[model samples]
Target: MAGRVGVVAVAQTKFEEKKATEHTAELMYNVTREVMGQTGLEFKEDGTGIDATLAASYDLFSGPAGAYMFLGYVVGAYRREDERVLEDGSLAVYYGAMQILSGHVDTVLLVSYNKESSVGKNLIEWVGMDQIYQRRIGLDFVSAAGLQAMRYTTKYGITPEQCAKVVVKSHRNAANNPYAMCCDNITVEDVLRSTMLCDPIRVQEAKPTPVDGACAIILASEEKARKITDKPVWITGFGSCYDHHELGYRDLADCEALTTAAQRAYKMAGITNPLKTFDLAEISEQYAYQELLWSEGLGFCGKGEGGKLIDSGKTQMGGDLPINPSGGMLSGLPVCVAGMQRVAECVVQLRGEAGDRQVPGAKKAVAHGVDGPAGQLQCVITLEN
Candidate 1:
């Protein structure tokens, strides 16, 4: 907390429907190799290279409780201090920053990825519920999200058309992101007319495909960061919170967890006004309606004003503050990796490396992610050039 934790390098693979040709280890190695190559750092334990390694992933998604052992070797963690963040990927960055800020490590490597296509043995979403309660009630993320969508939209007067606009914008923005999954142009009419999966939430409004991808980032303290790169992106602030697990306990219309987590990060970053404080935002939206709900939670607008925010085109690529210029989670990011992708995108943007989706003169950005049923858990990280 004294100096600063900075992200000196980052890399990610093109998110796609499947990566059957490559194993998960390959994904990890590819990104780790690229990121380390960018910084000229190795796994030397002599205090001159990466001091620790962190992997952001979920054991459930990988189908083995102790999978990190096999992964550790692939990411150059052989006999090195390697740990895993079982929640959303953004938290790994949070944990890595803390490691450096605590003076326990000078440099860290974070690799986050999950092949959604390989999760065939279990229903990752449904299995997340309690066995005796929610599971018996038959609730998966889609249906549960549907319940939230109806409650949020009805309570806030957010029209289904307004939610559809999110899908149109996501796909359109994905075109600018070469690492994005297969993207096709779509319209609000197209989203509204698409297959209705959960009443107001249409098929087109959800992540179009299960994607396999990996993202890697190298983090260092201020002293090492300056030596690694002239354009180091600093991790100025961070926060995470988990709400009540039971759907019955929460008000489906509002996400208090997201607001609390965001407020903590904003306070640390001295962000009194999110819309004016940051030039852009990368939010993890599993569904289109979530983008609206999360924007409000992030304090982009007043309560019940999320619908107006999206409808105004204020969150577009060329708007006052672009939201998801790199196509966000709705484009195809898997759950665990989605939040980390948001952070990686922010690093790219702040480094002036995001080619077509770049936000001009973007000195600041926020990356967000959520887990659990209906955003029960939330994470926020603020980054700056």
Candidate 2:
């Protein structure tokens, strides 16, 4: 782990909720080429190729066997000799990091693409709902957030006004993100007045149904990193964990998976108090209530105290622990690309390259991602200067 794996270059497309005309591959290729160009790595001119290529997009999002071949060409790794193009982009980043640490690869490229707009459903909650038990009971994703929000409010006395604040805060924060899919001057009243997608969880409270986009990040070992970029954001620690997929079997209010994952990440980074140790955070707030729920899961506050924590402005950019400076998934969700987008944003922030949305003087950041219905899968990565 000492050789050091750092993100050298990162690029992303503007997130949107619909892309009816363009193919997903077009965005993926554009982002990949942009990131590689930033690394000054040219295939024909440099002779050295990326040690590995990783991409993520579930089978349902893309039409069929056609998408794989499409990706092969976009990455410039189209059946290169015996080289394998990994399709699980998130897992690819995990393995890419392992390869760099294990002396197998000096550099790796991670890409993820998903177009929720192309699919005829609310891709966010639709994908997570149980295909059998839960979906049969009419348990869609918005209801999942509503259920969790209700549980959180009941357990902690979080009021509707407070929930409105989270929505307003996210939109206000997102206004600063140029690549964000949705943002505008919105007030707490605006959130409360919006159409309710699910009881207690309004349309504005939810991440916009993602349109289409792709993201890519170039990772290099210490030796390769120093040669490429002067400011390389080091990957100090990473942790991922999963909870019981059955929503009925677990405490809906608490994210034990996140707690455990955060603990491991903090341990690896040698951090004990996240509030005091980390300068900023890019938490996944797919729902307004989740930002509050995960704040507790991440140990930003005592159990049942996340509502109060937000009330005190402790998570604002100028506060003690700013969370979701990118406006988070609430602004946009490219499904598979969302998690990696969080990572790339952190790296950009760490490198002082986040143009208008940069958190002032940010040196350390914690990015979080969730997969599965009812928060079943969680990934936590801690990055530092």
Candidate 3:
């Protein structure tokens, strides 16, 4: 792709249960400062610093009418080009990349923040559902995920033990990640014996740890990227899709939206075989079973074979196609910031800067994120060094 938009620098706060001292604006400022400091760029209109800014935040979660009002001061968007995205933070990256590709900006600053502990998480999530039908049934992300997990496991004959393995792997991998919140060494037995939140979804198997964090990334045009950093992670391909809105109308076992999104990304990246093409994947596995389900959706394996893929040990750290070397979303990234963290992890690996969790000689990577009920909306981004 010509006029490539490359990730030159990325920054993120340590995932924690609560950022007690820092407010949402402070969190955003911290990450933005780090990225700007890394690039030695300022917010100016004379083509000397970031040409534009993109931010992501939810008004309900941030407890403000216009959440971007808090970020504009930190991102230095007072009199510059700035826009707010109401979806996942990864969408900012997608939109920023498009702006660069359109020859409108040389450098774009992207930032996203979420403090899950500051609000009633359930109330915020419930508001996003279909108020007429899904909202009254008492379904949030967890219950919706449970519904998908039960269906996927039942149809594919995936056992509870298989799902437990995903949790074990996530925590084990997170041990090397200083920014991850859940890095405890756990076993499949521990997972199986943990509290059961819903049928087939154990407390450990679900997002066991909720976190508060912020992430920022600097995207530059091909010309400016080479000057900003020698190891620029290029955004080669990206795509997003939306599935059925209502849970009753959709097939929970198959992630048609995710598959279509991945296929669109793979086609743009000239990747014919995803299983052998990318060195690693950073998936937003909101639940233990999602790792297996999303692996199938990403075409790492055939349909209903996610369990076989796990059993093959191919997704292990030293295995053929390692998945979530940074422990992924299971390690406790904030809800809206989850996908942006995946993109940051990919940038770290592609730059050969992941100190302990580095994938050796990794040149290409895929990062995924989903929103809405039961993975209704999906986004896939492919990056290369």
Better of 1 and 2 by TM-score: 1
lDDT of 1 by residue, 1-385 (tens): 6699999999999898889999898998999999999999998969999999999887766768777767778887788898789888999999999999999899999999898888751378898888898888788777888999999999989998899888888888989999998467888888888888888788888876578989999999999999999999999899989999887788889989999999999999999999988899999999999999999899999878988998788999999889999888888887788888899999999988899999998999999988888898899999999
lDDT of each: 0.89, 0.77, 0.89
Please, what are the lDDT tens digits per residue for candidate 3 over residues 1-385?
4578899999999999988898888899999999999999888879978999988877788887686785577877788898888888777888889899989889999988889888877788788888888888888877888899899999999999989999999999999999989998899999999998888999888774548999999999999999988889999999889898888788899999999999999998899899899999999998999999999999999999999998899999988889999998887888879888899999999999998999999999999988877899899999999
Question: Residue 199 lDDT in model 1?
Answer: 82
Better of 2 and 3 by lDDT: 3
* Prediction-by-prediction clash tally: 0, 6, 0
The RMSD of every model to the true structure, in order and in angstroms, is: 1.1, 2.5, 1.1
TM-score of 1: 0.98
TM-score of each: 0.98, 0.93, 0.98
Per-residue lDDT of candidate 2, residues 1-385 (tens digit): 6488888899988887777777877887888889888988754424265767666666577766446665666776654421332232444555567778988767877778887776654543565577878767877766777787777788888777777788777777888889887787788888889998877788888878755888888888998998988998888877778788787788888889889988888888898999988888887777888888898989899888888988999888788987877888888866667778888888889988887778888899888877766567777788987
